[model samples]
Target: MSTPGKVSLEDKFGLFTDHWSPKIVGELNGQQVKLAKISGEFVWHAHEHEDELFLVTRGTLLMRFRDGEQRIGVGEFIIVPRGVEHQPVAETGEVWMLLFEPSSTVNTGTAGGERTVTELERL
Candidate 1:
């Protein structure tokens, strides 16, 4: 069994300094909770079977879809359904976000690139 305790978001965010790299913080059921600091643009991709949830904690995130775009600000979240191609961009500045997804989900999805993280580091 795992010990129970508090997981500080600020403390977790402080452990990493890379963009687009998500560090695992906690897990529940079959899902993993991750934190990432991102700026600039991410590649367009889609998970065939996993949906991804992104909650903005720091700056603004512009989520672009094939159809349109949605602006996610602090405390706001957006879930991208499986098989939907989308991209996230932080044009103004760095953005901190919490990601919730199945443990099997990959960061880059089908659009594998240099940013694809097959193995994630825990915070």
Candidate 2:
């Protein structure tokens, strides 16, 4: 069942290590579902045009927004509506994430900081 253009999760796991970086695995409905491992604290930023949905599959994720902040563990999910600034944090170590974002959306938007525009590896 090894068909072309299909990548196993294990294969993607072996392709990354950098923190706060997202890798595009595939696309659907004009959105890209990316897999990333994040650690420490990322800048508080947002896409004024696109909303962000994050689902934690293996660890913990903290969503810090201008109004409030919340922590989610495995099996939990959070959505930061458009035009809201937010930051993500992972304490102690790493957090695995599945990001659902528009196909044209970049990792960072108008607030593009140091982590802006990181290269994505093909999985």
Candidate 3:
């Protein structure tokens, strides 16, 4: 069992400096809340069985789809439904965001590569 307490997002974020690597901050109801500081572009991928929720904490995030793109900013969020092909990009600068998804969800989805994180580190 894990200890129960309040988690400061900012404080947790301060513990890491790498980009694209998500650190688990908390879990609830079989889902995980993760944090990542990202920049540049990610691979085009899709979660066949899991939907992903991205909530921006700082900077900007542009979610690209085959149809179009959505620019998310601070305090903004977007959900990419299952089976939808999408990619996340930070063209402006570094972006900090919280990800809410199932514990089984992988960072790279079906497009596994060097950027794929199979095991997540807990903060």
Candidate 1: tens digits of C-alpha lDDT, residues 21-92 = 999999999999999999999999999999999999999999999999999999999999999999999989
RMSD of every candidate to native, in Å, equals 1.1, 2.6, 1.6
lDDT (CA) per prediction: 0.96, 0.82, 0.96
Question: Each candidate's TM vs. the true structure?
Answer: 0.96, 0.87, 0.96
Q: Among all windows of ten consecutive residues in candidate 3, which has the lowest summed lDDT? A: 1-10
Q: Which residue pairs collide, candidate 1? A: none
lDDT score, candidate 2, position 118: 57
User: What TM-score does prediction 2 earn?
Assistant: 0.87
Q: Write the per-residue lDDT of candidate 2 for residues 1-123, one digit (tens) a residue.
A: 886686576578678887777888888889988888898888878787898889887778988888888999988889888888888899757898888898777777767878986566666
Model 3: how large is the Cα RMSD against the reference?
1.6
lDDT score of model 2? Answer: 0.82
Cα deviation at 7, candidate 3, in Å, is 0.9
Clashes of each: 0, 0, 0
